[model samples]
Target: MPELLDPRNDFLFKRIFGSEENRDVLLTFLNRTFMEANKPLLSEIILLNPYTDKDSPTDKQSIMDVRARTTEGELINVEMQLFNRYDMEKRTLFYWSKLYTSQLVEAQSYSTLQRCVTINIVNFKLLKNEQYHNVFHLREDRTGIELTDDIEIHFLELPKLDAGSISLQQGGLANWLLFLQGATPDQWEVLTMNEPKLKKAMTTLEFLSQDREARMRYEARQKFLHDQASLMEAAKNAEIYGFKSGVEEGVKQGIEQGIEQGIEQGIQQGREEEKKQTALRLLRLGLAVSAIAEATGLSEEDVHSLSQSLE
Candidate 1:
């Protein structure tokens, strides 16, 4: 058996579900997801951003989201996210808002806008609850009254899914989620035996996994995703560190400025006494000797002497 590529990879995911050739596969997956959630099923869909082969180097970095419109004119955005940057909640809302607002043209009435749904298949757990699948909508908090049916968001956390509990014989959303979570060949064979849509998807995955050119593209896409995740993590850490450092520095400067003002108002002996007291207080606050020196206008040696005298 050829090594199978991870369907969670955005590149392979778009090719599997967003391709025009496998429209039925996309339809089946969407219907299963909706039906499992007790929501209205999509009968027909028109792919908006259909998958196209990336032939050139520039084309290899194309956006890998699948945008479609249902027969009811409802827009659906499906995308697989392999890593959690801790901003999915806000990002989902931002994208959903854009999609909803973009539907209306200049001077077009609000009634012209259609319902927009975003389906996010995430590899990592997002919500605090144990449930793997979560759906959200605009609803009143006190009375459970739905404000509008215009917006919807679904998060399918693959890491939280229990494949062992899912029965392939039922052939519902669980089976599809399992398939995307990289089930083994034997498991795929069993799943495909029961689910025809899954069988078709498995065939496509196999073909793509085996093709040398497709594998190369998949590897390149995987590397790009890894590099992007690393960069995002680094950026987030830097932001947090910068915020904390700025706050500490601001507080220290504020204390130093107030002490300097007092020193300017008093005699030289009083100023030296104030400096010693300030240094002692900073030392008690666990500030470093160098920081106390900088804040108190005293040399490091004087700060050290003050610290010893306090001890």
Candidate 2:
């Protein structure tokens, strides 16, 4: 069955902010989170690349990209982090610095640099001391003086939040965060006291979550995420296998590909290579041509040729 509320599920995430309309909805929600005055706020907030190392050729390097800037001149970068890589903190700082620096052109002064906010939705805890959802702003360490208002960082640890304890009136953003992290088939009735816009937001989320098309979209996203994770794992495995006195994994991948071609030549080559490799002990065990052919999805003659070649 398709999952209803997994952020890793692409469909659900897209349903949240994938399209222009949905993005509009989310932008509105984010604005409300700030308690911004009811004026025309953010006009356009575009999603850019989310991964830290954009230039890296490795498939494992690229991650889900989600960054945007508001119309009223506020920048927001949101990332959905699954694993706690050692460099996450550093990478976030680097991105923030890069974004901050990119604002100033050859002639523009640093004073013109607008305020930017980054929200990281990490599945794992980030800071060691602060356990709850935390927001960081620049301030003087000794005298508690405000350094600058141009930057803000908010970190939400999904596993650390509890929806029941959060108040609808006092904790608006907190409620929203809880809703996002809440389990599937959540009791919507308990959340009726939220702000009007948040009520609308929940309605939207509920409608999208229940829709069949939305379900399919979420399934497709899950598949994509799964494929990406698999690719990264495969690359890591390849690198590891390359390092150790072992080419067995590489040879195994190649032979598996060959065997999938159901043709005589392909099967013969696959079996011959497999049989000779001491690493593949199962292949070394003698078996009838028909038996080998059946097991590997190769024809009997092809298996016989492979057996002969191996001898």
Candidate 3:
């Protein structure tokens, strides 16, 4: 048996955008996303917390929650959504609103607000539009003026992101997506280029996917996703389980009830702190920023800053 594949592990997803050694790869990927060929890349990254345990926690599954940020003082939230729970839209709105508003404390002024990017990785399609990646932001209708480029939301649909075509090999998103979907070892050689960082990440991910224990966890998650997809399909066919309109109606009520009681219900805040400290410690041990970032939730920028502070 091979090593189990666990997508919820930050140590596993480190290939995506965590690690100083792979910083160049991350910068390259983000640069491509920015639409400017040579623009400066993000200096830091605040990785999304995968676990719900906030304080001192054990390494476990990978289910990157709704948010993380960049070291350049930018907030980046990456969410891995496996099901189309009825309140996904509203839930997203609520989380985003919380993140956006949480920037300032009671005594802090609004000027201290930071830029935020919310990236959602969903199994379901968010819109009926043609694009796989949809970005939303506030903009002036008439002049096309962005009231603030500070807050942005990026949605990536796994089902819609096709990789069989030749055109996609041009940049980082394709490469990263393939990596995320657990590309085959045979496909690894096909990803030819002198890009050492990306190659390293791909190699690392491939190696981990071979672990039997990891593969078991990954298979379990895959099965869960399959089950959810089937449920949605059955409901679409007017099946009994899908006819629960009352459940949908009660979702908002339940969420409201939870919120009314001041229950945030996730360890995002605590996880962020833990990841930050872990990143700093790893950096002190002379580990690569990308690796450290992936292992912890700190961004390359944050790690670099912490690394410098220690000097």
Candidate 4:
């Protein structure tokens, strides 16, 4: 038997549930996902960025996420992320803000903005909890009062899903998550027997996996994504190492300069100058202002001022 393609590949993911013909499959999956999270079920959705098969193999620059608008005008964006970038929290909030604000024209009021939901299917674990499915909302800390139902984010950690314990008969969202994680042929057979929508999804996956052109495109996209992930990891490592080196140098310089100056005021000035220099170096390295401030022991406001001056 031929090996099945990983449905978590964003390209294949889009082809599976981002097309007009597969709207029902997407609808069922969304409803099940929301219900599992204890949210209202979606009755209807209109795909904003419908999937289209590429004529040639392309890089990962192509946007393959599915964007939809519900019957109530709530926006939903779903994307399969294969790598953990360590910035998903901030990235999700940024994208959610854009989606929520993009609904209105110039004269529209804030009341016209609708809720925006982001569903990220990550191949790696994100939360510290043992649960595979994690949901977020804007709620008060002490009283647990929701500020509004406008912001919703769900993370489905594929690695956290227990394949052995997942039952097709009972696992509503688990069935879909397992399928996306590339269930074996035997598993697919069993899953299809229990979930009708999943059967349709499996058919689409098999069809796309077997197509010569589609396979090439998928391979190309996968390669591009891997390359991007590798680059990001390298950059993160470099930033960490550089920060450590800077801190060490700053401490060494502070001690040496203080000893050489041999006066209370001189020592204070020396340490201050060293810290400022370290902060400047970190800023030049493109570290975030908060990170630079934390590393250099400078106030966030000072770091921001330094960053602006450098720019």
Candidate topping TM-score: 4
Q: List the residue pairs that clash in candidate 2.
A: 11-218, 42-71, 43-71, 50-65
**Candidate 3 lDDT over residue span 32-126, tens digit each:** 45542233467655444433223121223333343446666777666667667556667777777778888888999988888876667666677
Question: On TM-score, who's better, 1 or 2?
Answer: 1
Q: State in Å the error of residue 203, model 2.
A: 4.4
Task: Write down the lDDT that model 1 would get.
Answer: 0.88
Model 1 CA lDDT for position 103:
91
- Model 3 lowest lDDT segment of ten: 51-60
TM-score for all predictions? 0.79, 0.56, 0.58, 0.79
Flag clash pairs in model 4. Answer: none
TM-score winner between candidates 1 and 3:
1
Residue 195 in model 4: shift from native, Å? 1.2
Tens-digit lDDT track of model 4 for 1-311: 35667888888889899999999999999998999988999889999989865423354343778899999999999988998888989988888888888998999898998999999999998999989999999999999999999999999999998878876777589989888887877787777666778989998888887888788888998887888899999999999999999999999999999877778777788898899999999888888988988898889998888888886
C-alpha lDDT of candidate 2 relative to the true structure: 0.61
State in Å the error of residue 186, model 4.
0.9
Model 1 weakest lDDT span, ten residues long: 54-63
Which runs in model 3 stand beyond 4 Å of their true positions? 1-29, 36-40, 46-63, 66-68, 192-195, 216-311
Q: 1-311, model 2: which lDDT tens digit per residue?
A: 33445543323444465444566656755665455323235556765543232222223433344567766566777666665554677888887887788878999887888888776777767787545566778999999788997778767777776665666566355666655665344454455455445565566667766777656655655665567667777777777877773577677877887777657787788776775442223346865656666666656676666566667
Instruction: Give RMSD (Å) of candidate 1 vs. truth.
Output: 12.0
User: Which segments of candidate 4 are over 4 A away from where they belong?
Assistant: 54-62, 258-311
